[model samples]
Target: MTTTTATYDPGLIDMTNEANKKIKVLLELRPALDGFAGIPQEVRLLFRGLRKIESVDIEGLLQTSHRRLARGTSDTGFFRKKISAARRYNRISNVIISMAEKPYRNVLDIIMDYFQKRAEVASLQISMVSGFGKIKLTRFESKSFEDFTWRTIFSKTLPASDFSLVAPANHRVCSVPWHTLHTVGLSTLNWRSTPKYPKLDTKGFDIFIGQTPYPARVDPDTAYVIRYHDAIPIFMPHTISDKSLHQATHFYAMMSNVKSGAWFACVSEATRQDLIRIFPEVTDRAVTIHNMVAHHYFLENSAFERVPGIIRSRLYEGDPSKGIELLPKFFSLREKENFYKRSLGDKHFKYLLIVSTIEPRKNHTRLLAAWEVLKADVDPDLKLVVVGTLGWEHSSITKAFSSWIDRGDLFMLNAVPAPDLRVLYRHAAATVCPSLGEGFDFSGVESMASGGITIASDIPVHREVYEDAAEYFDPYATMSLVKALKKVLYEEGAQQEQEQMRQRGGEVSSRYLPEQIIPQWERFAERVVAERKSIKSSTTTVFEEKNSSVSST
Candidate 1:
């Protein structure tokens, strides 16, 4: 084998020039492989193209080396041929210039630039769990009133006061503040194992915000803060095998990060109580912050439109129409038999809307059963539209939908688009969600925001979100739901009652606006930072005293 060296002017052979040369070589060499046509055309073309660029430059050399190995070149003679080609390519003065000015001068240098730029900004430092992908900060805008309330508190309040938002890469909710925090998008699945692990700056952040408690032996150097998103144990027990063990583990993990003095924020007073009950030692650390809904949702916007035709089609196609005939009974006017007629008649259907995943916890089965009984007894014009996906863990619960597949008085729609949902809420006679349990019922408040009367389960979270603006019902009592539905749907003065509730819902939802909640978050964060600093000083003093006593002994 012999190496070929071609010397050319250095300035003339840049990336573009080299690339053009490689292309010209490939075009010239294509006919040479035709004599041995046993190989596929693609394979032959690839082989010739790689050989043409083998002596061009570093990038070309690297690409050629990869191609030759992929083609199964085991012969020492063939290896020597490629190696000689690489040496010959380096000797080409033009090729040397092209390789010398590599695109990325130093990756580390670019990263350092990013760090320095960030240091100059009035930024929040936040770390998030990224298991699913980048945390979508924008999704917070569309969050249900419950989630939105918590989000506003964290993003506006906490960060303004210099608290750092940190969580596992998979933690979805906390990652919403990435834009403010200067953390990379939530999609990056990088987890830091130690305190100051990301180590952007050794001074360390003022406070660390986490949903789950930190593991034992966390770096003592950084202050740990915990915010309880929900009392999951109280509501989601059926979803877990052993509630006690889960609570115990959760309690242990949360306390491990407390370090004798740390601030804990909870979504509601009920959640704070539950946390203290489960972890008595951490009771002193907890503070209750009632969740809030954004004000815009509660305000009437003329720009808001009804559900789109395509989304409505996707949700209602092939689904049961059991309650179609009952529309006249629920509402005095039955304009049309199908959705098109109902949508076209008055532009707003004053009917009940139920938003929930089709599962047992949502009590869809009993709701359906009660609806069936009501349909048989009443005139039946009011419509019941069930929206949301069919989640798992409920075998008996899901059967009700299947049973009512052809019935005209009932309707089941899974996963309707948000715009349509908003429209549905605005036009609804009332929005009803009688869940067995809920961390914070989003549907009820959203319904209220849309100026619809809200009927919900008698849960503490619901009370906090709805206050006295919602009609409450017992989850197990089918008749209670039926009575509430009938009253809201058809009783005299029902419309007046509905309007009053809507007004109150609008008033209550204002507190959750970004402006109101953001400042509160700022104060909470400042307090957490101050408290953590005090605790650290005390711990240091105790450690020094113990060391002195041991040394004297």
Candidate 2:
């Protein structure tokens, strides 16, 4: 045999490295036949898709994931062909690496060996990716920054680097933002690591970021950018989920892995300050990257113009009379009444809106207490619309407010879609976020963007973000909220104040537009890339087992 070699572009070498990593990742994803034994084939397919899987036949990629998952794979030849294709794709002239030529056992070992030294990748920096490791490994999915809507919005407005993705934002509110990525032509890269180690072979990440804390464990060669979304879980233990303590412990354990010059994407200045106050070592690296509002809000939707009442009713009533298209046949007269009655009730009335999950930290109970005091004296017909989903540690909240909900004075719309939410925010007299703590509150911004007055808690983040644009009140004291509520609801010239606040909403919230946040993200990514080039990956980097201990900053 002649010493054979084929010349190829450096890009092929990069592609080969990525292929090896992908193949190694697939090996770990072969669903255990134990519980999956009796499950439907559709379920198997769903899991496979989520695990970043592809079909053996190129045609299979075109099929609906559910259909493919339902059919399952029967051809052993397909697996052989799939592996062969990846190896073929990896081929380049004069390259010594050959997964195809090796024995199966050697191939597995070779792939494992490559991943073991993932830091020796083509790129200058290794960006750590987080695939909800905290939730996946622990089965603890209590509402956190990883579960926030900002994750979905960030993907659309900003170019995703290493760690941001919601996978499937099925909710209407999330659908537009998630799909916006495709319009922008950016793929959500996988952030998951194999059982061996993270696959940082080709296309080394400049910076790895997740909505939660994920320390890239290989060493100082990689920059492990932690999402310091909030410090409430550490401080307000009573307000967190039962498994949150376990999650926090896991988060802190990964802090030791941040030696390679960590950075932070702070949600607000107040959050940045809190981070610095707690971890002085990170003061230099922390940056205030405010969670942004979607451009759609400012462009075509409710930012400036209120919807025409005739058109709004036509859409709601399914009449199609205002030059709108025909409604689905299933949409009936009775359903329209149900939609209106459930949301707005039989009697149309303006209501105060509170958009937050039903949890202890939201201060809904305090708001309710204020409502009770205010309702007894004035505005008997005033309604309180609370929009959000049920959260943990909320039994007492439901118990206390159950009667109010029953009496119809308090209306709760859980997981209201974006269109309906826009309407609510558009028409609501005011929107309030009385949370005890937050990384960056969206309720006030979302509502304020829709020309609604905002009243938030006296929390530092609220002050920093709202800054006189919103009225503030003590969330702890019942009367404090009552007094503030009365001044806004009953006080004279309050309409003028709301109009003024509406103008300020457009002004203040401009800071959170995609135009604003996108540049920050670009600048941040540039800095990370430049920083990576400036400092080479240190040779003495430490690679250790997943130890569960929080390292001091």
Candidate 3:
């Protein structure tokens, strides 16, 4: 993965019309790397936000009408297959064509031809062909990114691509030549500004965007640009996946596949700092591009709506200072009602909400412990509403979750639909986020945008994202969280304070809006092309020198 390092700048990109500024791209993709069943939910959910404007067939609105069985599953996995089948084709046509009434889906166009296998990068360069995983490859055309998102949600297997990570609503990357691939699982969650480098067996495009590393001994001319998320695995070796060798590389590869000469688009300033800490020399090769929030879904306006009456009745509070009437413009009435019936079920008890993967790093155990103390004085009927699928090291909280559920003290909505989630956010007494670390803390921001009071772990990322908009607590101390929850829930004038906090939270969200993010991407694309050309010229000189030496020999 070694290469001649080059300078990278965040303020560079082709100034030509954005629509016309297309680069010859070679994406190194691993479509079937599984979060569960050969797919990374982060990348899949990203496609769900593609609007009709980005590309007509995107969202697969015009995908073939008839649905069939998914590639690998048998009749026993029928339910899962059915959900997958609907998502891959035709499911979102109505929503885009008829129901889409807002300009929220407007996003920057990212056009590229996708390659499903690592081998494809070589074949496409040398032979103009490649193969992909049978199960995941076929899904390229059949599976709709929009459908896969919610279907995975209902199936309770959706990986942790929370909206705050802002995949779909922010990006519009459409793989043009990708039409032929069956449906391979795209494993990357971020590729928006991944222009960076190394070598490959064959060469055409100077840059590549995908999960696979460049072939070990590649043509020095090939530049592999990787989307850098975090340096967590390198610093915290324990977090590295037991199944993969991606974290293991030589000197240049030690810190990352990122070598000296490649351009990288990091997800946050914090992430850029992580890269810099490992490779101080990479200061010029990396630039910080903050992650965006799906403001369209959580703020402004949304496609779904519930009746005002239903919302008013459910969120009824005699206090005038209570958070403003929940915005019904965002919820699907039927969906919200059904969710309520299933979760709340004829009960009118107030609830506190937490939306995130249930794992140790997320610090859910502490939240549970805090709730144990808070419930004693706060209202016995106040339910802890936990939303999200389980993640690794969840055994620590399994007993706690089970005991609470069994005692009817908590409601576990593992993977509710987007609309139902918005409903919960709007009506909940307040949302809690007690994570220990994160590349970005979307839950806190999302809770605020959804008009819920957010009490977050006083982590740097949370402070960066929520600032004074949220009530902060020491994540390590259950008492701190208990106190914060108490102040937001039981303390007098809490409603007015929360309502004001929600407004400030809305203001904070503006920074992560897509408008604020798109310019960073445009500049990133520009620098990538400029650097590639510069390195390619250097490679040409090397070739000329080699030829002269051969002639003399």
- What lDDT, from 0 to 1, does candidate 2 have? 0.48
Greater-lDDT candidate between 2 and 3: 3
lDDT agreement of model 1 with the native = 0.46
lDDT of 1 by residue, 225-253 (tens): 55465556555766543566555445444
Off by over 4 Å in 2: 1-203, 218-222, 299-348, 537-553
Clashes of each: 36, 2, 28
Question: What are the models' TM-scores?
Answer: 0.55, 0.58, 0.61
Which 10 residues in a row give candidate 3 its minimum summed lDDT?
56-65
**Residue by residue across 498-532, what tens digits does model 2's lDDT show?**
77878888788787765566545444544544455
Error of 1 at 31 (Å): 57
**Candidate 3 backbone overlaps, count:** 28
Q: What tens-digit string does per-residue lDDT give for candidate 3 at 260-374?
A: 3556566556666766787788677777665555542364343223422233343421122633221122257796566555545534567778887766777888988888887
lDDT for 56 (candidate 2): 12
Q: Mind sharing the TM-score for model 1?
A: 0.55
Local distance difference test, per candidate? 0.46, 0.48, 0.50
Worst 10 residues of 2 by lDDT: 56-65
